[model samples]
Each structure stands twice: as C-alpha cells, then as structure tokens.
Target: MSPNSTDAMKTNLGEAGAHLKNAATDAGSAIKNAAHVAGDELRMGRSAVKADLADSALAGIAALEEGGGAAREQMDQLMDKGRDLIDSAADLIRERPIASFGAAFAAGWIIAKLARSGDR
Candidate 1:
C-alpha cells in the first residue's frame, strides 16, 4: 500500500476508536445517574413511612393520656364516696353507744371483706 493511503487509514481507525470510547463513557455516566436517582427515590419512600409511623405513635399516646385522665377522675369520685360513708358511720357511733357499737362492728367486718376482695 502507498504510505499516504496507509497513514490516512490509520488516522480514520484511530478516530473511530475514540468515538467508541466516548460513547461507552457516556453510557456509563447515564447508568450511574439512573442508579443515583433510584437510590434517592428509595430513601424518600423510607422517610415517608417513618414519618407516618411517628404520627401514628403520637396519636396512640394522646388516646392513652385521655383515658388516664378519665380513670383518675373516676378514682377520685370513689375515694370521696368512701370517705363520706366512713364519716357518716363515725357520726352515728358518736350519737348512740350500744347501737353505735353494733353498727361499728358491722362496718369493720364489711371493710375487712372489701380489703380481702381487693387482694384477690
């Protein structure tokens, strides 16, 4: 082959190789960008789930707090009733001696029964 023709052919082949290498690099860069986008989407989804769970937990706690407040009010009412009954019995015993003793014995027995029932 002529030297000029050979040199031209070599130059053409070299240009084609450079073009192929550039195309491969571009494809690699595109693949990396797609992977990065997918990773970001996954992280965003996880964050959304975590936020939902946190909101649900907060709602549950609010419900529990409301229930606790209601229970406390009921307990206070029971304690007040118990105190009134005890006070009434003491007043009756102070007003009458023999009758008061019998009533007092009955009250003590009932109180003991209630205490035992609570233990069970």
Candidate 2:
C-alpha cells in the first residue's frame, strides 16, 4: 500500500476505537444509574408496605379493644340480672317455705325418674 493510504487507514481505525470506547463507557454509566434507581424504588416500596402493615395492626388493636369493652358491658348487665333473680328467688322462698320444699321434692322425683330411664 502507499504510505498516505496506510496513514489514513490507521487514523480511521483509531477514531473508530475511540468511538467504541466512548459508547462502552456511556453504557456502563447508564447501567449503574439504572441499578441505583431500582434500589431506591425498592426501598420506597418496602417502606410503604411496612407503613400499611403498621396501620392495619393498629386498626386491629383498636377493634379488639372496642369489642372487649362491649363484652365487659354485657358481662356487667348479666351479673346485674343474676343478682335480681337471686333476690327474687330468696324473697319467694322466704314467703313460702313449705311450698318451696314441696316443689323441690317434686323436681327431685322427676329428675330421678328420667335418670333411671336414661340408664336403661
């Protein structure tokens, strides 16, 4: 080949190699930026999920507390009613001792009869 042609060819090859090196550098930088962005997005998503779970757990605890209060109220009402029933029964027994005794005997006799049948 002529010296001028050889020099031109070498110059062209050097330019091409520089362009390829610049392209590779740009691609590497783009990949690194993308990985950083993905990591940030993942962190944000995980934080959001944790916040939602904490909120849900608090709501559940509030609901359970409300239900427990209602249950306690119901238990208090049942206890009051039981006390009233016992007072009424005591008054009735005081006013009619003989009749209460006869009724108790009858209930016992019926229970015994039913128990014997079940045994058979």
Candidate 3:
C-alpha cells in the first residue's frame, strides 16, 4: 500500500476508537444517573409508607379511646340502675314485714321439697 493511504487509514482508525470511548463514557454516566434517581424514589416511597402507617395507628388509638369511654359510661348507668332496684326491694320489705316473712317461709319449704325430689 502507498504511504499516504496507510497514514490516512491510521487516522481513521484512531478517530473511530475515540468516538467509541466517548459513547461508552456517556452510557456509563447515564446508567449511574438512573441508579441515583431510582434510589431517591425508593427512599421517598418508604417515607410515604411510614407516614401512612403512623396515621392509621393514631386513628385506631383514638377509636379505642372513644369506645372505652362509652363502655365506662354504660357501666356507670348499670350500677345506678342496680342501686335503684335494691332500694325498691328494701322499701317493699320494710312495708310488709309479717307478710314477707310468711311468704319467704313458704318459698323455702317449696324449694326444699323440690330439691329433695331431684336428689332422689
């Protein structure tokens, strides 16, 4: 081959190698940038999930507190009703002492007879 042609071929080969190197460098930079962006997105997603879980837990606690208050109020009302019933019974017993005593004796005798029959 002529010297001029050989020189020209060497120059072309060098230019092609330089272009290939630049393309590889650009591809590496793009891959690194994509990985960094993905990492940031993953971190943000985790933060959002953590926030949502905390909100749900707070809502559950509030609901439980409200329910506990309602249960306490209901228990108080039941205790008040029980006291009224006991007071009523005492007043009735005081107003009818002898009749109450005789009625109680009859009830006790009947219960004893029924219990004896069940044992047999």
Best by lDDT: 2
In model 3, which range of ten residues has the least summed lDDT?
1-10
lDDT of each: 0.96, 0.98, 0.97
Query: In model 1, which residue pairs have backbone atoms overlapping below 3 Å?
Result: none
Q: In candidate 1, what are the lDDT values of residues 67-86, reduced to their tens digit? A: 99999999999999999999
Q: For model 2, where is the 10-residue window of minimal lDDT?
A: 1-10
Query: What TM-score would each prediction reach against the true structure?
Result: 0.46, 0.66, 0.63
Question: How close to the true structure is residue 54 of candidate 3, measured as C-alpha lDDT?
Answer: 100
Per-residue error (Å), model 1, residue 41? 1.9
| C-alpha RMSD of each candidate structure in angstroms | 7.7, 3.7, 3.8
Total clashing residue pairs per candidate? 0, 0, 0
lDDT tens string, model 2, 4-87? 988999999999999999999999999999999999999999999999999999999999999999999999999999999999
Q: Which segments of candidate 2 are over 4 A away from where they belong?
A: 1-7, 80-105, 118-120
* Candidate that would win on TM-score: 2
Mind giving the per-residue lDDT tens digits that candidate 3 earns over 31-100? 9999999999999999999999999999999999999999999999999999999999888889998988
